[model samples]
Target: MCVSHSVSPDFCDKVMFLLAQEHRGPLRGGGGAGRTAQEGGGAGRTAQEGGGDGCIALEAGGDGCIALEAGGDGCIALEAGGDGCIALEADGDGCIALEACGDCCIALEAGGDGCIALEAGGDGCIALEAGGDGCIALEADGDGCIALQAGGDGCIALEAGGDGCIALEAGGDGCIALETGGE
Candidate 1:
């Protein structure tokens, strides 16, 4: 099943077709002013958009669950589990937070002044964050974990455990701190 609010009919149809092909249950899309929330089940995917001063939240579960959000001066929070993947983009001054567990992957991009925080646990977890005049904090645990952060006039803090790897690249005035434990 597919549901869309404040979005074009063509977009709704395309989302339905894509969900059907993937055999994933349910797709919800919302746009326009105010806050929006999108949730999916059974390895599903969700996308949301919010106008000025509006926030968006997305959550999903099961293997291959994905969530994407875009907004302005509006924060975005996404949470998923079990091979979950999430991507977030924020315009203006807004923050993005993403958390996942078990083979998770997350990417966040912010325009203007904004911050990004990402946390993941278990095997093969990867996270990337990029923004301007914003801070990025990433933490991952277990094997094969990787975290990368890049920004200008921002600070990056990365922590990993057990066969973990972390990279940080900052342009202009910025600080980078990396920590790893156990191999």
Candidate 2:
């Protein structure tokens, strides 16, 4: 869904796109206002380029939101500015979630047999939660906060921070948490 520039600030609200197959190109959900949700095999670019003030939720094998590109059997989410929030949840044999933004809050949850949650925030905050047989959480960026939690077998958390990185893991399986500082 695309909104015109003349539209009001609250023009877009709670827009959702669901696809069973793969979505190529960019799938727009709101030009400058409202919430966007996409669920399916995934999408290449889920939102408008540059930046916009909106919320996005993508759960697919490709990607979600702005410039979101999810891999096979993966979920990706992205948001621009203006109190934007992005949440991605993947459920498949192998689930993966990817999120990025400078001022948006990103949350990724992957639940399946082998789940992986990856989040990156620029001057923002990211939260990654995974569950299933083998769960892993990876995060990177600066001036951002990352929280990772995994359950099941072979759980690992790795965080790379441009400013600071935080990681937390809990489960009965083998778990590892690693944090790295900026360069």
Evaluate residue 48 in candidate 1 and report its C-alpha lDDT on the 0 to 100 scale. 40
User: What are the models' TM-scores?
Assistant: 0.42, 0.39
| Candidate 2 lDDT over residue span 108-183, tens digit each | 4555666555454554554455556566654544554555556566776545545455645455646675554544
- List residue ranges in candidate 1 displaced over 4 A: 1-52, 55-68, 77-87, 97-103, 117-123, 137-143, 151-163, 166-183
**CA RMSD for every model?**
12.4, 13.3
Q: Who wins the lDDT comparison?
A: 1
Question: Candidate 2: how many backbone clashes?
Answer: 5
Cα lDDT tens digits, model 1, 57-133, are: 34445455555443545445444554534434445565554444444344334445555544445444545454555
For this target, which candidate reaches the highest TM-score against the unseen true structure? 1
